[model samples]
Target: MKIPFSPPYINEAVIQEVNSALESGWITTGPKVKRLEELVCKYTLAPNTLCVNSATSGLMLALKWYGIGEGDEVIIPAYTYAATALAVIHVGATPVMVDVEKDFNIATHEIEKVITKKTKAIIPVDIAGWPCNYSDIYAIINKKKELFIPKHENQEKLGRVLVISDSAHSIGATYKSEYLGKITDITVFSFHAVKNVTTAEGGAVCINLPEPFKNQDEYNYLRCFSLNGQTKDAFTKSKAGDWRYDIIYPGLKMNMPDILAAIGVAQLPEYFEKTLQNRVEIYEYYHTFFKTKSWAILPPYKSDDKTSSCHLYALRIKDISESERDAIIDKISKEGVAVNVHFQPLPMLSLFKEMGFDIDNYPVAYNNYKSEISLPIYPQLTKNELEYIVSTVTNAVESSL
Candidate 1:
């Protein structure tokens, strides 16, 4: 019984959507992309959304739009993927790394400790589809508002540090009965091949700024900014005598094409009721099977106030070293079960190590990484496969111990 990890749920409906986009003869950032953005806004109940080539680009675009550049500092959890920190680096800003809690989210107290006059943003990642504590983060931001020094007009308008949620793993996830997109000032959702929803390689930026700052105006500017600052996109220029346009700012080419957006359009309609529901079932199955095991520590998915997207079933083993965890993964693989680690702490990576980050400083992140193993939790897995995965992981852990 061979089980693969996180394959995109591409069915006939997805194929038809892509075919329609291919046959339309207008593929680059056109009606389909606009339609996806509209669907995302409707789904998340956000005021506006901007589709980009990737989540990394979306994060960078948000940072640039806020004028967060050299000498500025943005706070991020050290447990997240490098893309979170890389986005800050691309904008010439320093990424102030902080520790995560046992629930695999940025510690709000750690965020408070790092707040400084140069702090411009706080990017809290929703690890493995679990929503971060935005309410606590907001409280910290409010308490430290006096420490924030606005450098740009947009920054001044915002009045305090911006909260950009690295929601790559959490699209349909909810907190306190509200979807994740509108939870923060800016939320970036990834549609990579392995995500809950796939656009092949795309992302959407949900804009929900407080009043005095118009979200629609920000969306319009970002839309243009994504297309190399062109006043008119190629699809618009294709119209009769609409070729004349102007460059507003030197922006990056980060717009999503119609073809990729087509995939998301087809998936989102069924996401809540079907796709996400299936993933949740798989998550529950794993939890039920592992809850009885004294050696197993299950990841959080549902509570009274939060519901996860169930992107990854990251299971941690009790009392294991990092090398022991690696051996267990090896054993699982030998049984034809594919598994993974959510991430290594950023400081453990060579790039961050060279930047003076030490994994020892982020004990919780390192602890989580050492014993963690991400099992497959996609909509396509069957009951038989689910049993196989659990049996295999149980055998692997017991043998390793």
Candidate 2:
């Protein structure tokens, strides 16, 4: 009766795609990568999409392109994983960590309070595939628009604060009846192993900008940025009499190889309606099962304005300390049912602490962290396995108490 948490849904179709890619001699950034980018554009309805090696790289590129740098400040929720804050730090910007709402999203009021003239961007993380309140975030940015200072051309072109969505867990999510890529200035999605849709080790950056700034230009620039800022990709260079290329920007090597892109193309065709439907059903079942328990504090998966991708079932244990929550997780593990915690807020982590942040300042983030335990909700779980998970989790929780 052993159950693992959040394994990627790999089937024969994914393997076939990988096999086809292996057979193809052009394995690095070729037709398959181009096709995946096109599929991403069609699926998300974003004007342009760029596939990168990982979500961290996508977020970093977005920050760099938006002109976030030394002396500039990027606001982020303290409740998110370290990658959210790390991107800001790696770009040499000061990360102003804000408290999160009870729903594990950055507080709009907190965002406003921390915003100053140095504020260049705000990275709002969809902690568990649930879309944050972008409408309210947009409103806050509009109110504070007067204070934002542009340090570079790209930033000035937008003429306002940039909203870079850390949508690592929320690829297929919807906000205000529109896809996630449409809500933010730039949205980064992860295709890590545990994600709802995986590409082994890959990510995509969806650019959505207004009239003054062109998404096509941004996409072209990002393509270069992902490939060591090369003037031509490997595919183009392979053409006869086209071995010439140039380095345009001081970009890192982060382009997605064709093999990984092949997997993405296979997994993406029926993602929204077919693949994601399984996760939604599993999430709903957990919600229904947990509601009858007094100790269960359910995660917000569905609301009037948004529906999550059901990436993580981050259930909280009401009135419990962090130790108690850990004890419950240990009990479940010993019983062969694997569970996890979505995150420990950035301030509590060693890196942010050394950087002069205090977890006490982010009371809301710590409160949310102390009692949270993420349950399994992948697309591959059978009915019998799910039932066993439910019973084992219930029994383990009671035993721990």
Candidate 3:
């Protein structure tokens, strides 16, 4: 009856694809990587895409691409993983941590309060597979356009604030009937082991910037930039008499290798149907079981205009103290059931604490974090195991209370 947390869904097809890529001579940023990018563009409907090593790399690259640097400010949710805010910090920009709504996405109401002339970008995180309210975010940014200061070339080109989505958990999610990458100005998707769709350790960036910046041109630049700004990659460099290459800029080494990309290519065909559907069923059952209990507060899975990828089942035990929540987790662990917390508010972390961000300032984020418990849900989970989990969780919470 042992239950583990999230695990990668690796099938024989995925294995064979990776094995075939290994058998193939080219591996780094080759045909397979290109295919994954193409598939992502088709799936997300993003005009341009660049496959990178990780979502953190993608986010940092986007911040750098937009010329967000020292003295600039980027807003992000306090409730997300450290990578979201760390990306802003890596770009030398000040990250303005904001609160999140109960759905675990950035609080749109809190965004306006932090808006300033120095605000150059806002990285809205779509946590737990739920897409952020992009329509609301866009409206807020559009309303405050006049107040936004364009400090760099990329900034001046758009003459407005950039919207970069931290979409690591929400690749297949939809907002207003549109996929995540298309909803924001730019979106970053992670393919880490625990994600719904994994490429071992990879991610991609989707560019949906304003006019005057053709997506292909941006994509080409990003491709070169990611490979240490080399004009030609090893693939092209291998061709006869094409040995020489030039560095366009001092850039990052974050390109995805073809071996990893092969897994993604194998995953794309059945991602929305089989894998995501499995997590969705897990979410539904959790809701069905927890709804009978008055202590249960379920995460939002769907709405008239949106649908989740159903990545994490972030359940909240209402009217409980943080200590009680911890106790419940301990009780569950004793029964061989594994669980986790989505995140502690950024301010609660040491780095942010030193930066002088107090968790008390974000009351809503703190409230959500204190009671939140993430349940295990993956495609391989069986019906009997799922039933055991629900019952175990129910007993754990009630007994702890």
What TM-score, computed on C-alpha atoms, does each candidate reach?
Answer: 0.99, 0.98, 0.98
Worst 10 residues of 3 by lDDT: 268-277
Candidate 2, run of 10 with poorest lDDT: 268-277
Q: What is the lDDT for 188 in model 3?
A: 97
- lDDT of candidate 2 at residue 387, scale 0 to 100: 90
lDDT of 1 by residue, 125-182 (tens): 9999999999999999999998988889999898999999999999999999999999
* True-structure Cα RMSD, model 2: 1.0
Q: Judge candidate 3 at residue 120 and give its lDDT.
A: 94
lDDT tens digits, residue span 265-323, model 2: 88988687698898899999999999999989999988898999888999898898999
Top-scoring candidate (TM-score): 1
Q: Which ten residues in a row are the worst by lDDT in model 1?
A: 268-277
Error of 2 at 150 (Å): 1.3
lDDT of 1 at 257: 94
Cα error, candidate 1, residue 77 (Å): 0.3
**Angstrom error at residue 340, model 3:** 0.5
Candidate 1 runs further than 4 Å off: none
